[model samples]
Target chain A: MNAVIFNGPRKIDVEKRPKPTLRDPTDAIVKVTSAGICGSELHMYRGHQKTATGHIMGHEFVGFIEEVGSDVRSFQVGQKVVCTFSPVCMCCWFCEHGYSNRCPEGLAPFGTQGLAGGQAEYVRVPFADGTLKSTPEGVDDELLIMMCDIFPTGHYGAMRAIECFRSSDLVNGNHYTDLDSPKRSGLSKSQSLEEAVFVCLGCGPVGLCAILTARSKGVRTIYVVDSVDDRLDQAAKLGGIPLKLGRDDVQAKVMKATQGRGADAVIEVVGNNAALRSAFDLLRPCGVLSSIGFHQGDLPFTALECYQKNLNINLGRAPVRTVFDEAMEVVAANKEKLASMVTHRLPLSKAAYGYEIFEKQLARKVILVP
Target chain B: MNAVIFNGPRKIDVEKRPKPTLRDPTDAIVKVTSAGICGSELHMYRGHQKTATGHIMGHEFVGFIEEVGSDVRSFQVGQKVVCTFSPVCMCCWFCEHGYSNRCPEGLAPFGTQGLAGGQAEYVRVPFADGTLKSTPEGVDDELLIMMCDIFPTGHYGAMRAIECFRSSDLVNGNHYTDLDSPKRSGLSKSQSLEEAVFVCLGCGPVGLCAILTARSKGVRTIYVVDSVDDRLDQAAKLGGIPLKLGRDDVQAKVMKATQGRGADAVIEVVGNNAALRSAFDLLRPCGVLSSIGFHQGDLPFTALECYQKNLNINLGRAPVRTVFDEAMEVVAANKEKLASMVTHRLPLSKAAYGYEIFEKQLARKVILVP
Candidate 1:
C-alpha cells in the first residue's frame, strides 16, 4: 500500500507501506477513498511539533470498511464512513457526557504516537463502533472527509462562541444598530445573534469553516483577519469582511463597525500569541474567545487582563465524534461553498507537493486519493 | 463622619472625614448600619494591591437610604438596601445582559480607586437604581451585608462550578458511585449534581459561603481545603469534609472519594499559583474551575495544559447586582450556617483590630457597626 510518511523537518514522502489489519475485536480495516492534509499537520511537517522520521501522516479521511472485527457491531464490511481524528471508548463517563476527546482511553490522533495514518490505502480503526460515523446521504467524499476533523472543530468553536448567549432570554430577536452608549449614539443595547458582531482571527481552512458555520448559525457579520491576501480573498468570497493583519488597522475597523464596542465573539483558529492578543483586544466587555487553536505556549495575556475584560475563554480540541453528526448538517447545508474550499486534489504519490503548497499558503484545502 | 482609612501597608486607622454628598443625579446617600470586611480587601489591606493612603476601606455593606437624588427613582430615603461592591450604569448593554460588573461606564468598586468605602457613618452610591438592592423581608443586617459582595460572589463561584454540569443532559438524576475507568472500578459513568463531587480550594468567608451555596443547590458532598484548623472546623460544621493543606494529601483524598475521577468541579476562591495548580490537578476532564479570586500574577498553567485537560475556566468578578436577588435566596435558605461565618463584630473605631485579625487568619468574617 502507498502512504504519505513524515520524513523529518519540512519533509514528506510517498512510499510503499504494509497494509493495516484489525488489531482488536472492536477494530476495523478501512480502505481510504479520500483524505485531507489538515492545517494542523503543518506543525509536524515543519518540525514545530516533533513527529517520528517515518510515521503515517493524515487524520482526516473518508473510507470504506474493508473488514470489521467480530466485536464491531455498529459497522460492517463495505460501509462508507468518516473517521474522527482520535478514537474514544463509548462507555466512559467523559465519552457519555460528550467530552470524548478527553476519554480516559487517551487521545491518540491517527498518524502520530505509533498509530498509522489513514493516508495509506488501508488503516486500522480501533473502537470502530464509537469512532466511525456513516457518511450522510448526498454528502460527497470531500465534505465527509472534513466532518472527520476540521469541520466539526470549526463548528465546535462557533457553538462555544455563542453558547453563553444562546441560553439568555436576551437572545430572542433583539437587534441593536448602535452599541456605543453615552459617547456616540446615546442609546445602547445588548446584541442578539443577528445583531452580534464576530471576528475570525485567521482565514485558514479551519477559520473558513468557522466562518461558514457562524454564517449558517445566523451570525450576520464576521470580520476575518489574516496576513495572506489570497486567504483573505477566500474569506471575502465566503461573505466575511476581510482585514489584513499588518496593513489594515483591524482593531480600528472592527471597533468602528461595532460602534466602538468590540466583537461579541472572536473565533481564534491560529495557535499563536499574536492571534490571542488580537482576540483579547477585539472583544466586548463580556465577550467570548472561542479558541480551537492547538497552542504550544502560555497564554499571551495575564489573569488580571481576562478579569478586567470579563472575558470568557472556551478553548480545547473539538470532541469530534460528539459533534460529528451536527457538523455534517453544517456541511450538507452549504455544500457548494465548502466544495470550493478544495483547491488541490492529488494522487497519493504527490502528497509531498500537497504538503509543500499547503505550507506555502498556496492551497486552501488539499485532498489525497490513495 | 467616622471611617476606616488605609494608612499604608499593614496600617489602618479610623479617622474623622467630611460627610459624602450626592455627586450625581443618580446618587444616593446611605447611612451605614453594618459593613463587613471582605476577603478581597485583604489584598489592599496588606499592600499586595497598592491603594492611596487615607482611602476608606470596605465594600460590603447594608444600610438605609439617608438621601436620594432626584434621578434615583428606584430607591428612596429611609429604605433599607444592600449595596453591591461596584457601581454600574443601569442603561449600558453590559448591565442589561447581566454583566453589570463590566458595565461600559466602568467598574469602580467602593473603597478603592478613590471611591468612598461603606465602612463609614455614611457613603454615597452612584447609579443607585442599578447598584442597590432592596433587603429581603426578615433578612438580618448581617446577612444583607454579606449580600453586598461575599455572598453573591460565593454563589457566583458555585453557580459557575456546576454550570457545565447543570446544562448537561447527563445531570438528570443519575448517580454513579464508581468513576474509576478501565483501570479500577470499570463501571465509570457521569455523576449528576446530587451525586457529583466538588472541592472548594479555600475556607475563607467567600469559600465557606460557596460551600453553603453548593449544599443548598443539591450538591451532596464538598471537600473543603484550608490550612487553618479553625476555618476547617467551620467548614466541617457546614457539612463540608475538611482537608487541611500541606497536612493532608488533598489530591489522593479527592481521587479516592471520586474513585479516581477527581472533582467534577473545583471552586477556586484562593487567588495564588499554588491553589491554581491544585485546582488543575484535582479536576476531572471537562471539569469547571470557577475562580473568583483577585489574582495578580500570570496563570499557573499553559494553554496546552488547559487544552489537554479540556478545562473550562470561568473566572472574573461576580456580577453582583445581576445576581443580588438570587444570592439573597441563598442567604435566606442558609441563614444560620452563614451567620456563624461572622466571627468578629466591632464598632467603627475598632477597624484596625478587624483588619489585623482578619489578615492573621484569626477572623473568619468581621462586621463593623458604624
Candidate 2:
C-alpha cells in the first residue's frame, strides 16, 4: 500500500507500506475510498505537534470494510462506513455518554495507531463496533466523507456557541441553562428569541459550515471574517457576509450590525491569538463565545470580561458523533449548492500537490480519491 | 449615620455620612438591622477594587422597611427584610430572562448604586420590590443576612455543579470518561455513588456554605480545603473532613477516599489561582469543576488537561435570584445546626474593626448591629 508518511518538519513522502490487517478482535480493515487533508495534519507537518517519522498521517477518511476481525459484529466485509478521528469502544463510559471521541480504551484513528491510514490503500479501525458508522444508502464518498469529523466539528462548534448564547442571563434570564432545555436556545417561554447575528471568524470550510448551520436555524445576518480575499469570497458565495480580518474593525462593525448589542454569538474557527481575542470583543452583553480553533501556544484572556459580560465559558472538543446526524441532514438539504465547496479533487497519487495547495490556502477543500 | 468607608488600602475609616433618603422613586429606606462583614469587603479595603472614599463598605445586610418612595408598593413600613446584593428591575431584558443580577436597567445594591455600605445605621435600596425579600415571619438577622449573597452563592454553586456533573459524559462507558475512569479497580455502581466524596476549596464562609449546601443534599464524604487551620477545624466541626491547603494532598486524599476516583464534584469557593487549579486537579475524570470563588486576578488553565480529563468546567457569579428559594429551603432544612457558620457579631459602631478582622480572614460571618 502507498501511504503519505511524515518524516519531519516540512517533510512529506509517498512510500510503499504494508497493508493494514485486523490485529484486534474488535478491529476492521478498511480499504481507502476517499480522504480529505485536515487542518490538524498541518500541525504535524509544521512540527507544532510531534509526529514520528514514517507515520501514516491521515485520520479523515471514508472507506469500505475489506476485512473484519473475529469479534467484529456490527460491520461486515465490503460495508461502506465513515469514522471519526478518534476510535472508541462503545462499552466505555465516555462512549455511553455520547463522547465516543474520548473513549478510554479508544485508539487515535491515524498514524499514531501503528496502522496505515486511509491515505493509503487500507487502514485498521480499532473498536469498529463503536467507532465506524455506515452511511445511508444514497450517500456517496463526497458527502459521507464529512461524517469522519469536519462537518460534525463545525456543527458541534456552532451548537456549543448556541449553548453559550442561550446561557446569557441578558438573553435568557439566567446563565443556568437546563441541559434539558431544547438544544437550540434554552430560553424560557418569557424570554424571546427574536433577532440575533452570528460572527464566524475564519473562512475555512468549517466556518462556512457554521454559517450554514446558524442560518438554517433562523439567523438571517451572518458575518464571516477572514484575511484572505478569495476565502472571504468563498464565504460570501456560501451565503455569508464577509469582512476582512485585521483590516476591518470587526468588533465595531458587528456591534453596529447588532444595534450596539455586539454579536449574539461569536464562533472563532481560526486558532490564532487575534482571532480568539476578537471572538470575545465581538460579543454582546451575555453574548455566547465558542471556539473550535486549535491553538499551538497559550494566549491571554480576561475572566472579568467573561464575568462582567456574564458569559458561560465553555471549552471542549467537538462532540462529533453527537452532531453527525444533524450535520448530514443539513448537508443533504443543501447538497447541490454546497458541492462547490469541494473545489479540487484528485487521485491518491496526486496527494502531495493537494496538500501543497491547501497549505497556501489556494484550495478550500482538496478531496483525494483512492 | 456613620458607615465604614474605603479611603485607601488598609485605611478603612468610619464616615459620619448623611442619612440616605429615597433617591429613586422606587427606592426604600431600611433601618439596618444586621450587616455581615464579607470577604468581598476585602476587595475594597485592599484597594483591589475601585471604591470611593466615604462610600459605604458593605453589601450583606438584614433590615426593616423604615420608609419608601412614592412608587414603592411591595412591602409596608416596619416589615423585616433581606436585601439581595444584585437588584433586578423585573422588567429589563436580563431580569425577564431570570438574571436579575445582570438586569440591563437594574442597579447593584451597594457600591454599584453609588451609596455607602450596609455597615451603617441605615441603607437605601432601589428597585425595592424585587431586591428586598421580607423575612419569613420568624427568620432572624442570622438567617436574613445570608440571603444577601454567600448562602445563595453556595446554593448556586451547588446547583451549577450538579448540572455539570449530570451533564458530563465521564462515566465508565462514555468515551472520554472511561479512558481514565478512576476505577482502575473494578467497582460496582453501588460502590461509585456510595464512595462519592465532595471537596470544597477555600474554607471561607462561601466555601463552608458550599460544604454545608452539598452536605444538605446528602452527599457523602465531604472534604473542605483551606490554608488556615482554624477554618479547616471549623469545617471539621461542621461535619466536613478538613484538609489544610499545601499541607494536605487534597486530590490524593479524595481519590483515596473514593478508592482512587476523585470527588464527584469539586466546588471552588475561593477564586484564587491555587484553589482554582487544585479544584480542577482534584476531580476524577468526568468530574464537575465549578468555581464560585471571586477570582480577583486571571488564572490560566491547561486546556488539554481539561479536555483529556473530560472535565466539565463551569465558572459564574452567583445566580442569586435563581437559587434563592433552594438556598432558603436548604437553610430551613438544617437551620438549627447550620447557623453556627456565623462566627462573630459586632455592632455597627465597630464597623472598622469588623473590616479589619474580615480582611485578615479571621471571621466567618461578622454581623453588624445598630
Candidate 3:
C-alpha cells in the first residue's frame, strides 16, 4: 500500500506501507477511496506540532469497508463510509452528548511513530460502531470524502456559530448587531440562512465548503479572506466576496456591507489567538467566534472586549459525528457541482505530490485516490 | 439627623445632615433602623473605589419605611424593610431577568463625593418597587440585615460552586476515572461530613456567611480561612472549620479532609485574581469555584484547565434577586440564633466609629442604628 509519510520539516514522501487490519472486535478495516491532504498535514510534516517523523500523515478521508470485526453490525463488508479524524465509542457519554471529538476511546495517531493515517491505501478504524458513518447509497466518492471530516467540520462551525450568536447579548455590549439577533431576523422553523454573509479565513477546502454549507443555509454573500491570490480567485469563482488578507480591513468592509453593523457570524476555522481575536472584532456584538483551528495555547483576545460586546466564544475540535449526516444530505442534494472543492486529485502513489501541493498552498482539498 | 459622613479615605466624621425627601415619584425615604458595614465599604475606605466624599457610607441595611413614592404600593408607611445596595427599576429587563444587582439605573460608586450609599440616618431608596423588600411581619432588624446583601452572595457561591465540577475523576486522567464512568462517593448526593470543610478567606460576613450557609446546607466540614485571627474565630463560633490564612496549606488541608479529593466548592468571597486562581487550584476536579467577590482585571486561570477537568468557572456580580427569598427564609427561621453573626451596634452618630472599626477589621457586622 502506498502512503504519504512525513519525514522532516517540509518533507513528505510516497512510501510503501502494509495495509491495516481489524485490531479490535469493534474495529473495521477500510480501503481508502479518497483522502484529502490537510494543512495540518503540512504542520506535522514540518514538525511544527513536532508530531514524530515518518508518521503516516493524513487524517481526513472517505473509504469502503474492506473488512469488519466479528462484532460489527448493520455495516457490512464493502459498504461505503466516511471516518472522522479521531475514532470514538458511540456508546460513551461524550459521543452521546455530541462531544465525540473528545470521546473516551479517542484513537488517533498521537505521535510521530503513530500508525498510518487516512492518506494511505487502507486504514484501521477502531470503535467502528461509533466512528464510521456509512455514506448513503449512490453518494459519489468526492463528496463522501467531505463527510469524512472537513465538510462536517465546516458545518459544525456554522451550526455552533449560530448557537453562539443566540446566547450572548449586552455582555458583548458594543458588539451586537440585529442581522444576527435571534430576537430579530433569526432563522424561523420555515427559514434558514437564505441571504446571510459569511467571512471565512484561510480559503482551504474547509473554508470553501463552509461557503457551500453557508449557501445551503441560504447565505447569499460569502466573504473569503486569505493571503493567496489563487485562493482568492477560487473564492470569487465560488461566489464569495474575496477579501485579500492583510490588505483588507475585514471589519470595516464587513460592517460597511452590512450598513456599519457586521456579518451575521464569522467562521474562524483558523486557530490560534490572533484568528480568535479577528473573529471577535469582525462580528457584530452577539456575533459568535466559532473557532475550529487547533491551537493548544492561550487565545489573546481582550476577553473584556468579548464580554462587553457580549460576543459568544466556542472552542474544541470539530463535533463531527453529529453533523456528518446533515453534511452528506446537503452535499448529495447538490451533487453535480460540488467537486470544485477538490482541486487536486492524485493516485495513492502520488501522495507525496498531494502533500507538496498543500504545503505550497497551491491546492484546495487534494484528493488521494487509492 | 446626625450622620457619620465618609469624607474620604481616613476621613469619616460626625456631621449634621438633612433627612432625605422624596426626590422622585418612585423614591422612598427610609428611617434607617440599622445599616451594616460591608467588605465593599473597605474599597471606599481604602480609596480603591470612589464614592462621594461626606456621603453616607453603608450599602447594607434594614430600616423602617418612613415614606413611599407615589407609585409604590407594595409597602405601607412604618413597615420594616431591607434595601438592596443599588436602586433597580423592577420593570427593566435586568430586573425582570432576575439580575437586579446589575440593574441599568443603579448607581455604581467609586471615589468619595459620588451618589448616596446606605450608611446615613435617612437614606432615600429610589425605585422603591425594585430596591426594597419588606420584612415578613416581625423579622427582627439584625436578622433582616443579611437579606440586605452578603448572605445571598455567599449562597450563590455555594450553589454555583457545586454546579461547575464536570466529573470527579478527570484530574488523574486515564489513571483512574475514564470518561462516562460512574460518579464516586465524595461528590455523591448522599455524601456526609462531620462539618464540610470550607476554607473561606477574608473572614468578613460574606466568608462567615458561607461558613454558616454551608452548615445550613448540611455541609459537614466548614473550613474558613482569613488573615484576621478574630475573623477565623468568628467562623469557628458559627460551626466552621476555621483555618487561619498565612498559617496553613488550605488546599492541602482541604484535600486531606476529603481523602485527597478537594472540597466540593471553594468560594472566593475576596475578589483578587490570585484568590480566584487559588480557589480554582484547590478544587477536586469536580469541585466548583464560585466567585462572589467583585473581580477586576484579567482572571488568571486557564480556560483549558476548566475544560480538561470538566471544571465549571462562573463569574458574576452577585445576583441578589433570585436568592433573596431563600436567604430571608433562613434568617426568619433562625433569627434568635443568627444574632451571633453580628458583632457591633452603633447609633447613626457613631457611623464614623463603625467605619473605623471595620477598616481596622475589628467588626464582623457593624450596624448603624438611626
CA lDDT of every candidate: 0.81, 0.70, 0.65
Q: For model 2, how does the per-residue alpha-carbon lDDT over B1-370 read when each residue is reduced to its tens digit? A: 8777667778767778889899999989999978887776676677777755656778888888999988888888998888887666666655555555566544454743265568788888878887888777666788778888998887777666654454343222221212122222222122232346678887888777777777765566778888898788878876789887678876778878866656778888876677777787788665667787766566556544544555556566775764566578777776776677787888777877877787776776788887
For residues A301-361, write the lDDT of model 3, one tens digit per residue: 5323333443334555565765565667678777765667677888878877777777777
**What would the per-residue lDDT of candidate 2 be over residues A309-345, giving only the tens digit for each residue?**
6554444556566556667888888777567777788
Clashing pairs in 1: none
Error of 3 at A177 (Å): 32
Backbone clashes in each candidate structure, one number apiece? 0, 22, 39
**Reference-based TM-score of each model:** 0.92, 0.86, 0.68
lDDT of 1 by residue, A245-333 (tens): 77999999999988797898899999887888889899987687888889888988887887677676766888777766667777888
> Candidate 1 docking category?
acceptable
The TM-score of predicted model 1 comes to 0.92
Q: What is the lDDT of candidate 3?
A: 0.65
lDDT of 1 at B58: 87
Candidate 1 Cα misplacement greater than 4 A, ranges: A168-191, B168-191
